[model samples]
Target chain A: MNVGELIERLNRIGALRYEDWRAWVIEESGNSNPTREDVNAAALAWLKDKADGSIWLDPEEEQMLGEFLENVVPKHFDGSVVDALAFLERYGPEIASKDVADLKTYLNSPTGLAMIEKFNGHTGEQIGEMSHFFQQESNQDLSGYQVLRELEGPESVGNTSGSLLAAVTGIMPQQPDTAASAAPAPEAAHAQSAPPALMA
Target chain B: MQELPLAQTHELELIVDRRNRAVLLHRGPELEDYLWAQFDPEHNGLTLFTEKGEPRNLGLAIPKSFSDKLARASTLKLISVSERLHAGRPRQISLLQTTEAFS
Candidate 1:
């Protein structure tokens, strides 16, 4: 199932599901067929909402959703694959209970990949072609992950810089008086103060 | 003055000399001293020095109501706006206060 279908099926029985997620999608986003990108954006928005305590979230369902995303979704976001641990670490604050990494091997075997392709909404012909590509190439010395690693070396490094961490990371922290040897920090300093709490 | 907590507090000090040149000093956690500031009177621009002497000015502007305070105040104590909003002073103008109290 695509993320949209997974969301629908999950809401049906109420376990491992986002209750009222469809209404929220329609009312707030006007998106009936949520794509992977949409789901990613929604998850980020939900995290902010959860932080604001404006929404109620069950721990079990959150863990289930996190796991489903980890297992089924490709790390490719914005046309790239980041390190798996980094991905988890990035989202860990939002998803507090899930262990994003799995020790189980062979989860992405040909059949499993075919299921993932279905989840990705691939046509039968695309799924068949992807399976052949996976087996024929994967049966060699390197796994599919290793192949991706070789292809996206620079992005996987995630060498974002420009702050104090830049000094430590060897990106050369910006000198206020000297020419900037590195790019300005990718983000402003983490906000020092928490938002004020107010009654809704 | 921004009071440093006795325990975990670090000190970043600004001292304006009689000649009207100001220098910021900081005793890092390791208790090592470093000079950390520069002011451009022509442009009314102020940039802080990184440990490496890089200039960092975030383009903060001081309103006249507050900027005027630096000309005469002999000694000033600062608390965050959240802590004491009615008496808050712009931190950038802090070093411009009359005859440095900590000099």
Candidate 2:
């Protein structure tokens, strides 16, 4: 079933079996129908929506969606996956969550399957294809993010710099300050505050 | 200005040094003292560097407001990271307040 049909089915029954959702996704986003590329694009778009807060997500649901996109969804694809978790972790608050639950609901449906198929292939045989595709996209996104940062007005530069977390990941904790290394006392003090809470 | 209960399952504590215009994350005592990452006010950028000065990119869990605030402050210290839970699961409202009051 295509996303459209799947939506229709969902509306009629108010719910769907996993099998039904999968079948519809397979039919709609199959090798011959929507094509793996189309499915992949849709999946990325959906993820972008999730990242930018264009979709509805509760906190738990948001956490789960971040995990699925970063871990499970990448397992199905072949190329190096963009770190969806990192993006969400850093910029989650900036991206506005939708009032409706449609995005979360759709992700749990066959539409998700169609997106995963971009990398996993028909039977999970295709690998690297989706990963490589995403890797390229991530590179482009990073470049764009950098360009945007450079273009920001002086008044907004600080906020944009803070947004580095959203555009990139893997390097956190390291402040760009060389002087921080010279001052260990504040660092220790910060650590001191955490233990009591962490221990609890 | 607000006191928030820390999350039991939180992996890291986010702190900001407004005097230095930096952001840092405090891991548990079991971790190294220098494992924290800070935000660079000059560059308005945060890059993860280990205690050994090795550079890499690591993921962090911080509310968008916290990061945004880092750019505006000179010495705000993050006292504790807190969250409110729903259905036994944590919500997204993780709070990172400074030691000094914000007027």
Best by lDDT: 2
lDDT of each: 0.29, 0.31
Q: Cα RMSD (Å) per model?
A: 23.5, 19.6
TM-score of chain A of 1: 0.28
- Among incorrect, acceptable, medium and high, the docking class of model 2 is incorrect
lDDT (10s digit) by residue, model 2, range B51-71: 465543223333444456554
Instruction: Give the distance in Å from residue B22's predicted Cα in candidate 2 to where it truly belongs.
Output: 8.3
Tell me each candidate's TM-score.
0.22, 0.19
Kindly report which residue stretches of model 1 are placed more than 4 angstroms away from their true locations once superposed: A1-9, A13-23, A29-40, A47-61, A76-107, A119-123, A126-200, B1-103
Write one digit per residue (lDDT tens) for candidate 1, span B1-103.
5322211232222222232222222222332111223334433333444345454542323223222322332221111112111111112112222123223
DockQ, per-model, please? 0.01, 0.03
Docking class of predicted structure 1: incorrect
Looking at candidate 1, what is the lDDT of residue B1?
Answer: 50
Off by over 4 Å in 2: A1-178, A181-200, B1-24, B29-102
Please report the TM-score between candidate 1 and the true structure. 0.22
